[model samples]
Target: MPEVVFPLDSTRSFTDQSLVGHNRWHPDIPAQVHVRPGDSFRVHAREWFDGAIRNDDSADDIRDAPLNSVHVLSGPIAVEGARPGDLLIVDILDVGPIPQEDSGPLAGQGWGYTGIFATQNGGGFLTEQFPDAYKVVWDFSGQVATSRHVPHVSFPGLVHPGLMGTAPSADLLSRWNAREGALIATDPDRVPPLALPPQPDSAILGTLSGSEFDRVAAEAARTAPPRENGGNQDIKNLSKGTRVFYPVFVDGANLSLGDLHFSQGDGEITFCGAIEMGGFIDLHVDLIRGGMDTYGVAENAIFMPGTTDPRFEQWLAFSGTSVTLDGEQRYLDSHLSYQRACLHAIDYLTTFGWTPEQAYMILGAAPIEGRLSGVVDIPNSCATVYLPTSIFDVDIRPSAAGPVRIDPGQGVPRSSF
Candidate 1:
């Protein structure tokens, strides 16, 4: 039988720091997730706002609500056989509704999932969209609630730890808190081979270029008012049924999480207007050993059918800079570099111990697609080039077994979109 985990067995106090008082914990699972059709697991979860507001709540509630202790996650359950260096594979068996007979919002059908970036409401892409956006504020006062404007989608915000293992301390808080910035692990098997960095004379910043990063930074600087947390770029992942990857910086992972969204559109342009709730969730975590791929990822936590509809897959490219066109501009200069990243993945996987065909098929099935989850917030730029599961030609199988579990619930973690 498959192992199952739950939230802190208490109604008010939980061992999970990320979800301690709110009853949410983020337990990261391995990326090499493998399971049969019958495999099942239960997760502990909490509302995005931690019982902040109620259905009858109004916009006024949002404006003055204390924007703290919102968006709770649950679980850090480790898989039985996972290790320190193997890939963790998550099999998304299925998703269903939690039967709640309470007087609050979830009258039978309620799960959370959103795209808004910023944690605090007030100003965001959702301003005009959600009438209550202006009043939105964080209120851990009572049962989790949000300002009255967001439409209830009733979808669980399936979150996964970005990186699984413990990360290196970011005492060096550069521009943003890299340490607390949801670290995810990757499989050496999935990463493309190490290629030369783009030449200064190479393509204009579109993806992975000095120019691109500059633009991104400039955008962050331009928008987002520097507050305690990393500005409006809220990207809450690591929720129920979500798998994330991270590098192993410490023997035990001291993971933190935040960026909880009640509901959001694809592009997190708006601050997820008043998206909060309260409840408990559960998860199963595993560790990866002897694997390190270079999608800039240390490990991968697989979430399936996928935590989201568009599940996670490794890709060589994510985003590119919006460089101006030259008089003699050519597609080769612009697209070639990205294409190479995709092609080179085959070699990268081989170095990690995969055969050419294995790597090729992996990429083939999971169309190395691009991601743009963080285009709206502080950065005016757009795009997150990535790989999708549809890229592969073969029916992929989980590679790891007997997962080693890693359940570390510490700190009030926050994420940037």
Candidate 2:
């Protein structure tokens, strides 16, 4: 099948009914177009937050933008032959920032930004330590990204779509909402509050005609976390040459893509991410009949770019155990523990001839990986930060210090771990 280009209208491609918002995914949203199995296409996606941000943006910019408007997605491109219980295989052919001539205000051309969301807003991995919102404007050129915000640090761009998924069936949507609603109710006051149901006003951002399902689906579609439908999993290595298999729960397997990033670390350590940029993705869509039954993936699975062989050189490792330095529990959450570990790694690198700000940039920009080393130990989950030593020119050692307390409920500890 020949490749098809989307949004067909160039003017509305960047900002129009095609862009989906309201943190919810609904099957009712009309498909922008339909393509047959084995067909290929190029999708243009806007930056997260619908380009409300700019390279010159500040914390105030992030503060003012509607927190609910995120992960601006591109489609419900119905795959002709796809059906529920099958696997929608998306082969990433190419990904890059939309060039300046074609891109609107959000174009990628020696410009982009990475950010740390405000803790009060309830997002980001390391929210406790970096409470205030921060922005780092980056310049991209010659396939590399550099920033005055993070002087002396630069790296090649490794572009990828941050959120990719198919529309969930009405039943799957109900189950996801019920489960997440209950989880958030347990801690309503948590930073980046849990219960982020779709708001009726969400339709204002796009063309959804305020259908009841649209509102509920939008509420359920918060793009902050990755779900079985594959919303916002920030896996950095899922670029070209990788094939992502998402379980189809609805007819046509309506697929969408957005939240494009020029680069990101393994965990997207910062709440926002590396060099968020508006871009185009060339992809091939295929289907596996009865793939869900064959693979047993309740959600989605990805075949990495390369075989199981390692990609980076020996990494400088740092471990973060669940118990904070003050001997308080961190709720035994692997994600929170991993954030704690990454913060510790950032803190340790401060001694290696870099400031805290530079360390934060390195963590996000470099090809670092965060791994869950162990989570079975009762009351203590451990995660590790693996920094590819080759990315840096100077050698550094493990800090004499240890993991610090991150859970604000536990109160700030006196000593740095």
- Each prediction's whole-model lDDT (CA): 0.31, 0.69
> What is candidate 2's local distance difference test score?
0.69
Where does model 2 exceed 4 Å of error?
Answer: 1-4, 7-14, 17-23, 100-104, 204-207, 210-220, 306-314, 329-333, 376-380, 393-417
Best by lDDT: 2
Query: Model 2: what TM-score?
Result: 0.85
Q: Give a tens-digit lDDT track for model 1, residues 1-417.
A: 235333333234233232232111111121112322223555444444444433432434444443333333332333444343444443323222232523334311232322223333334332222223222222221222221122110122232221122222222123222322322122322212111111222111111235544433232211122122112233333334454444433324433222333333222333432233333233343555544353334423332324444344443443443222232323323233332333345455444444433333232222234343333343233344354323233222234652222221121112322
- Predicted structure 1: lDDT: 0.31
Candidate 1 residue spans exceeding 4 A from truth: 1-4, 8-41, 75-87, 92-98, 105-122, 126-245, 252-263, 273-285, 293-296, 299-417
Worst 10 residues of 1 by lDDT: 23-32
The candidate 2 region of ten consecutive residues with least summed lDDT is 408-417
